[model samples]
Each structure stands twice: as C-alpha cells, then as structure tokens.
Target: MLFLKLLGAALTLAGTARLGRLLGGRYASRTREIGRWRTALSILATELGFGALVLTQALERMALAVGGHPGGVARRAVALLHEGESSAAAAWRQAVTEASPRCSLTPEDEATLLDLGVYLGATDQEDQLRHLKLAEERMVGSERVARGEQAQRERLLGTLGWITGVLIVLMLL
Candidate 1:
C-alpha cells in the first residue's frame, strides 16, 4: 500500500510537470510578452519538489511499519512493563533502536513511545514529553512543505488550462 501510494505520487508529479511544460510553451508563444521561461522553470521545479517530498514521506512510513518499536522495541517495552525490568520509554527507545537505528519517528510515534516509556517506567516523563513535542514540530513542518508543493502544482495546471481555453476561444472566433 505504501509503495502504491508512492508510485501514484510519482506518476502524478510527472504528469503535472509534462502538462505544465505543454501549457507553458503554448502560453509563451501566444503571449510573446513576458516571462514564459521563468514560469515554465518554476512549474518544473515545484513539481519535482512535491514529488520528492511525497517519496521521502512514503519511504519513511514504510520503514517505520517494517521496523518500528512494535516489531522489536514494543515487545521489549511490553516485557519490561510486565517484568518491571525498566520503564516503558526506555524499553521502547532501546527496542526501536535495536530493531532499526535509522528509524525517524513521527509525532504520533513519539506519543506512543512516551506512553510506553511511562508504562514501563523507562525514564523521566518530562523527557518523553519533550520528544513528543519535537515530533509534533517535525510533522507540522513536513505537512506544510507537502501542502506548498501541492498548491504550486495545482496553480500551474490551472494556469495552463486557462491559457488553453483562451486559445481555443480565440480560434473559434
């Protein structure tokens, strides 16, 4: 499912870029008046950027699903929770890193981690709270970046459509 979503995002990016280029060219030729090249370049850049963001997020999500705290760390955390060996936070951190050191957890993951940590008595509750806050900030940043890219792509496509329509109307007249 993650792979499919990533693939679809990639295809969307490519299609948007191609459509932008086609429309940009037509607009440039018709207007013969202003910054056609700049507009085209901007459209291309925005499309690529959006595609990269989607790909990166999708890849991260896939990695987390494959090797998150639940897979290994969660088990240890649960064990610690039951055995009273350590706290939930500590067990989660240890298990997650053990399973996959490369994991970049999201805000939701951090909340789960903190809850596990407290449940297991792994570390200070404050520390878990801090981690959760940081995760929230990161998630917000990622969301904003993604939204910006999406908006740019839509704007370019809309402009292209408008230009095409105008051209057709002119021809009909």
Candidate 2:
C-alpha cells in the first residue's frame, strides 16, 4: 500500500511537471517561429527584389533555406501554386490558414502573414518589397512580445505545476 502511494505521488509530480514544461515551451516556440518567419521572409524578399526571381522560384528557395513551420508554410504555398492555384496571394493565404493550427502563431501573427500574402505577386517589385518589409517589422514586434512573456510565464507555470502536485499529494495523504 505504501509503495503504491509513493508511486502515485511520483507519477503525479512527473506528469504535472511535464505538462508545465510543455505549456511553457509554447512561448519559446512562438518566439522562435516568428524569428524563422522573419528570416524566411527576408530571403524571399531578396529573391524577389534583388535576385529578380518570380514568386514561385522565390518561395521554392525560401522553403529550401528555412526549416520548421515557416518553411512548411512556404513549401505548402509553392505546392498549391504548382497545383494550378490561381494566384500567389491566394496560395499564401491558404497556406497560412492551414499552418496556423499547427503553429504557435497568434491570430494577429496569422493576420500579418495573410495581409502580406495579399500583396504578393499582385503588385510591382517595389510594392512587394514594401509589403515584405512591413511583414518583417510586424514579425520583429511579435517576437519581442513573445520573448517578453516567455521567461516569466515559463517560470510561473512551472512552479505552479509542482506546487499543485504537492498540494494534491498532501490532500490525498
């Protein structure tokens, strides 16, 4: 009976701790994901503006250069485009929408990407560059906000999880 009780308490602590860490990790992931988007967007912008590449080629290169969810977004967009999707803008919007649930991006972050997509391949080089620049700026701001929250939230939630576990064990005892 004593051994069973100890095992139960150990499981409770381990489970709660793991849950807390997972929750905290989301904030860190969000910041990293935003940074990846910024980097990938910069690559795409360079490909479009200076490399004189078309939207499809630029996206292909961006997908190759970046990894993780951001890269996934680019790859999905490229696939959609090659599959007879009408426009880059529509492809990008659909990609972002489909990727949103799988990513750590907030609604605002998704909206920013969607808005940037709306301008892609719909305008001249200079306008496209401007929109990419705007999207990069928004990503920078979002990353900063995510960074600010990550440490505090992680610590608080991590501690709370252990405390809750202890409280529960005590009550059971």
- List model 2 lDDT by residue over 30-85, tens digit each: 99999999999899899999999888888889988988988898889989999994
Model 2 lDDT, residue 72, Cα: 90
Using all chains and alpha carbons, the TM-scores for the candidates as numbered come to 0.27, 0.95
The runs of at least 3 residues in candidate 2 whose Cα sits more than 4 Å from the true structure, single-residue gaps closed, are none
How far off is model 1, as Cα RMSD?
Answer: 19.4
Decoy 1 TM-score against native: 0.27
Q: On a 0 to 1 TM-score scale, where does candidate 2 land against the true structure?
A: 0.95
For candidate 1, the lDDT comes to: 0.43
> Which candidate leads the pack in lDDT?
2
Residue 48's lDDT within candidate 2 is 93
Instruction: Give stretches of model 1 more than 4 Å off.
Output: 1-122, 157-173
Error of 1 at 119 (Å): 12
